[model samples]
Target: MNKPFLRPESGRLCAARAAFSRRAARVVQFGIAAACVALPLAAFAPAAHAERADNDKPLNIEADNMTYDDLKQVNIFTGHVVATKGTIIIKADRVEVTQDPQGYQYATGTSDGGNLSYFRQKRDGLDEYIEGNAVRIDYDGKQDLTTLTTRAVVRRLVGLTTIQDEVHGSVITYDGQKDFYTAKAGPDVAGPGNPTGRVRAMLAPRNGGAAPLTGAPATLTPSTKMQGTQQP
Candidate 1:
């Protein structure tokens, strides 16, 4: 399998078009909604096989307005768009999805309002969860890469309160296949009082006290998902 792209200087993802790993390719084929839901877990843990399978489940979306341009092969969802797959959830003002002729998918989500686009996902077989906020998020299903840009902040938590890891940067990128990530400052510094344009990260030491995630739902079964259709 090809290596996923790192955060490039342009603050945009530039993943090479190549075949994905067996695991990620299956997740990609499951559909865009499911793929987008699984891309935010780099802060929590290296998603195990079970986690990737969870992402292959059905993707549900809610939005005020949506449009699909068949000619251009682009789907756009706007106005309080919320997408969910299994335990993962994403909320933004607008989201755009497009596919390559080869059936690879790309998704971009942006928050037009003051608040950043939000993402949350439960860790595989763990009490911890991952959450993030960014002005925009980009996912490349062909490469199993997710990029967060503009005042990006990602955190890992245990039991909804105890933080396990946190990262702050202008751009943060995660590789789903390898469970690797890179963070850096963007050309334009964003966020409150971040004039120095530096990346800040706080990764909690392993073996820290962690409590079980009470009331968390059990894992859902994976299934062959319908492609490209919007959810009500």
Candidate 2:
């Protein structure tokens, strides 16, 4: 049987949880509470707008092995799968992709063993990027939504380095169209590091007069070579 991610109650665990609560309180004082509403803590800010042309771009994937089902129009890639669509990139141990009749594509990525799947996408017309990690990541092309489940953590980075904001929860649903996201807390995220398993966020103040960072169009390079079996 697999062990739970959460550890048993202990004095050390309680202290860690208390420290986390204090940090969360400090984060709220910084700015999270201003943009977030209570009960699961949803934030609506002027960030996280994904590249507009990403939806039109073709989905490219590389993996060590692949299985394509023509009747179902599904492609499953396993072993170090790296998928790219425009400025968006996802890396996982396994990825299943399916296309709709209208040409839109959907993808689900799963982690490799205990490691979490990774996702990154550049913000439209800005020098910022949105990155996330989770045990499972589901991307809906038609709806322009990315849902991260199980120990989800999402961050907004200024340029390539500076982390402007971040959120943590058991599940996070990011709507690219609306440029917003909602997070839910649950037992899946309950661990020794977070005993309460509550949603936590650190938001940067937007009242500064500084203009949004703008730059030339960003490009993504596939991480690995495409060497896999494909049957049509």
Clashes of each: 0, 0
| Structure candidate 1, residue pairs in collision | none
Residue 1, candidate 1: how far off, in angstroms?
30
Computed on alpha carbons, the lDDT of every model, listed in order, comes to 0.65, 0.77
Give candidate 1 regions above 4 Å deviation.
Answer: 1-50, 100-104, 187-194, 209-232
Give the C-alpha miss distance for residue 185 in model 2, angstroms. Answer: 0.1
**Local accuracy of candidate 1 as per-residue lDDT tens digits, 105-150:** 6678899758799876666677766677899988676676677888
Winner by TM-score: 2
TM-score per candidate, in order? 0.63, 0.70
lDDT of candidate 1 at residue 74, scale 0 to 100: 88
**lDDT for model 1:** 0.65
TM-score of 2: 0.70
Q: In model 2, which regions exceed 4 Å deviation?
A: 1-44, 207-232
